[model samples]
Target: MRRTMTRLGTDTIRRLPKVLLHDHLDGGVRPATLLDLAAQAGYQGLPETDPERLRAWFTAPTSGDVVRTQEGHLARFTPVLDLLQTAPALSRVATECVQDLAEDGVVYAEVKVAPEQHTREGLTREQVVDAVLEGVRVGTAKARLFGRRIDVRLLLTAMRQAADSLEIADLAVRYRHDGVVGFDIAGPEAGYPPTRHISACEYIKRENFNLTLHAGEGFGLSSIWEAIQWCGADRLGQAVRIGDDIAVADDGSAKLGQLAAYVRDKRIPLELCPTSSVSTGAVRDISEHPVDVLRRLRFRVTVNTDNRLLDGTSMTGEFTRLVEAFDYGLDTLRWFTVNAMKSAFIGHDERLELIDGVIKPGYAGLSTEHVGAAFFRMEDSW
Candidate 1:
């Protein structure tokens, strides 16, 4: 067992073997890649052509406020999506996505892509899936040459407002053996509830496939309730609004509402992206983010970069924010990493291999002080 009193620094956090469960492929296109694709495809919708300015443009708020409506934030993906219409463009984006995650020290990632959005170019849904999978394969091979071990998988997402969820669900199942791992429903969670895709969810469940829903971000607890109870979501994406169901008394004691209690008790994973949550108005800012409360209460909390380009965030940045806000050290960081590994949509043996083999050892090797009994006790339990 390793006990450390030193806080997790940027370099250490970057080197940690992190697992991501709720990242979006369309929302994470590199600014340079977007510019190149736009040029190649003859699409000219980008606000800025210069790489630095374009990066700033994507990350900057729409109305000079850091917080925006979920719909407003989502609209920023239009340029990226426009360029990703062709198979080659899709492959390039997917390859670059994996390379970026690998460079950021992601050990395993399940990236979500909506096939329906890429069909305007006349590519069939199967062709779209195959292109992305090819990119994943190419990216993985390239990463291995550089000694970066990143295992990437796909999650096929259906737009909640659309009626093509069952189609998307079938596609996800069809490609389960060829890099696709799970199913998800994304987009405007308010009016288009998860129940709108209940048939898709049921099909996934009946097929024993994994499902994660974008709940409690754009909407409130009802959305989360439907996603979990009605739709049988395996994970909740940015479930920050769950804090609404919790109360803390003046004495500093806490009480959980029924939904929150059930969520915590079941060890349901909350894929909380702190910066993205702020951008989407899920919380006012990182300081008020519910991840700290959920983590303290022992809910299965995992930090993620919901969108690297849109949020201008990475796994390193996410952990750095948490460390600054909550004073979290290596132990806390290790706990979060381990929690994500345990909750991933991978096989049990593979999950255990990453935890015991990669994550724990990586954290144990970091430079730190010989913190005594308290740290050792935590290590024993872990």
Candidate 2:
């Protein structure tokens, strides 16, 4: 029997309840808000003053070095990070981040931020955390007003090249009862291995806190090895290169090497960012991403929008592309959502509540004109 094509539309995918585990707060500031904040702070570093042009300027490169590909992706966040130095700016950014995610049908999300990067404007690290958390509070409250309910938390990041991992880890533990849920190390992963931040990882483990490491984006399998085996990471951020450890013979039989086998055997969650992977040159294109192979192999994989502004993508966009590329339907999308919820840093009961209560039933709504959302109203679903 021939296989029936399982196609999903962007409209339907947009309405499905999403659980996002990887998102950078600073990389997703609203354009209009950025302009308003610039005026309030008297900052003049914007490449384009107009909101539309400024939004384009972030991911567009008209000049020699401003390209938007892997080479120019990191440059897009320079001005954003600089603009987010003050407490108010951080809070507003966090608030809008939640609002946007909620609007995109994301019911649960953990937005990551590096507090050390935002301290240049005389705000203490604690103040930075406080401001972001405050914004999360306001954002959640505002989402309800719009008939959208979103739960957002923060994951404090430490620069892998810096000596502040221990400090950041301790800070995350300090706010465990608050909105902060986990600690992470992110930077250039080639020269700065995860082993370098052993103290922080150990500290988080000892404190019984959550830990995820950024690895295998611009590097190779060794970086992933160190992240999983050395640092004891609970999840692998941008672990696109873990696919390299799998080898295929001429007859099309695939084999997993020791490291890859270990990763798959352990069911370590991989926070795969397809669009950002292409933007960062981790993979040439979304169709070429390892997510398909990894999924077929039953690897613990989840989808994420790494930097919404830089990639000009969202959780919905990511799912749309995956559906288009792989011809996936509701089952495939649900798998990714459940993987994210299970891998989330929140407590087991909370995760189960969302997985069983919101995500599954929301997706079960009859497919109507609006991609499975017509039968279930936002207010009614909750």
Q: By lDDT, who's the top model here?
A: 1
Candidate 1 lDDT tens digits, 1-382: 4534556678878987889988999989989998898887777799898999999999988756555889989888888888888999999989999999999999999999999999997999999999999999999999999999999999999998899999999999999988899999999887898998899999999999999999999999999999999999989998889999999778867899999999999989999999999988878889999888888788999899988999999999999998888888777887888889888997999999998898877766653333543452354222
Candidate 2 residues 227-288, lDDT tens each? 98889999999999999998767875689999989988888999999999887777878899
**What Cα-based lDDT does every candidate model obtain?**
0.88, 0.86
Off by over 4 Å in 2: 1-6, 61-72, 249-252, 366-382
* Candidate 1: residue 84 Cα off by (Å): 0.4
List pairs with backbone clashes in candidate 2. 12-371
Clash totals, every prediction: 0, 1
